[model samples]
Target: MHPVSTPTVLVDEEDRIITVLAGRPLGDDWDEVHAEISTLLHDAGPKVGKPRKQERRGDYTSLSFGVSYGGGQRAPGNLVQGECSRTVIRDISQTKAVQRAAGFMNGCFAAYAPKLYEEYRSNLSQLFAEYPHLEQIFPNSVFPTATFNCGPRVVTLDHVDNTNVPFGFCAIFACGSYDPVRGGHLILFDLGLVIRFPPGSTILVPSGTLRHGSTSTQPNETRQSFTQYCPGGLLRWVAYGFQPVGSAKPALRRWFEEHHDERCKRAVGLFSKLSDLQQDRQAVFSLKGSV
Candidate 1:
């Protein structure tokens, strides 16, 4: 299948962006960037955890970095949660390369979907401000959390990241060499899109809601991906006055309960419609020191 030749955005009936095919923001440097990232992942070797046991992800090693407030952790204290850097970040000496890959993905997000970028930046900034002790995986990155799908052959069974921010976007950067037409296609089950995802390209999607995975690559080919996302619990922790939802004051809880529907509408409105994308892009660029 021929890949999408141009940048594209898919939206729902309410004009919310379901996904954005951000093309190759690195242009001629795609080969170089992906190669460097691939080398870094390869060098990480056992630290990256090969041969994933998860049924959802066929056979690949993966690691995550950054702070998370959910997934059955104890209630937060005065401060938010601490960083969750895995062996890849702690044991490997490729911090710079990892940071570079993250920045590249973040930059692609800022360039192609500025509004979503700003939203992520704003919320993450606020989260960090309230809890200054938390360590960010990459200070330049807009996302609060990131995952490295280290794979000699990375492919996934259909699944949704239900823990991620339901209305927020997750940036997925495809890396490593593979035949995009024959394999490495991103399948969005809900949207009915089988996007031919090329190496070094990025896509932003509502992963918490979209059932997505990748097609298989050839036996000899290599495929890997890096993803940046924010968990819904983190956002809620921020919105709940820097406390867990269950720990919020009675009045504050009452107010949130009363305005639940209104808040949902507001959350959905964060997505930029295709018709307004030009204006949104211009508005984002017009800001002083945008991105």
Candidate 2:
């Protein structure tokens, strides 16, 4: 399919992209798929490092795998969930289930927003060229590695995923046998839309800015969702020096100093800053940074 011709659930209506990558299976071999993902979550207890700091309660708990992004910070207004650091565990990235989850989201990025995906693809390719070993470190990811989340009854409260790139969409996949109507619907509070997100289906939301969450599940219905998102900082990190940057680096000062100018001078395509792109190439951004 022509990259431009691929289907998209444009965000113009209500900040959503529903089932852009429609009918794609979670993968073949349902039982094996189940086993691998099950081990990915249960292999460890609820590991820390969620974007939002949730109060300890029975109704909420999660285990995040893969790599870090713009997590452990604070936002404002409708998405004011604060951040706090905790143990960092990336064992899940090696697991097959999470890698497939990461791959699925990558494809969606390529399909829904080809331009941004090109940008993400360009930056990541540069990373691989310079680092070579980055290919092994982040095998399936093109930009920020997917945030592989596994949890039961993960009733995520309404909040924007502030960590994602302003120009990219967040990829989400629902798993488990949760009843759609009884609960487990992805709620876009701003749009008054409750998506009937069934198992094995993928949906996209502008989590970076949109206030979104899921309704509660029936007592017997279990809901486990796997999602992928890129932290805006990842774009900044790629743009700056493969290291975090900007005024918010009092804590990252030493690392920043060590690597600030250690960047390749490759031709920047979609990955270059939109402002710089406009000045250097006179490329006027339409929906570039709208989110």
Q: Which candidate leads the pack in lDDT?
A: 1
CA lDDT of each prediction against the hidden true structure: 0.74, 0.53
In the predicted model 2, the residue pairs found to clash are: 161-207, 163-231, 163-232
Error of 2 at 266 (Å): 20
lDDT tens readout by residue for model 2, 154-208: 6677777666765466787666656666777778887787776655556766676
* Collision count for each candidate, in order: 0, 3
Candidate 1 lDDT by residue in tens digits, 71-113: 6765322223223334455543246655666776677677656
Worst 10 residues of 2 by lDDT: 76-85
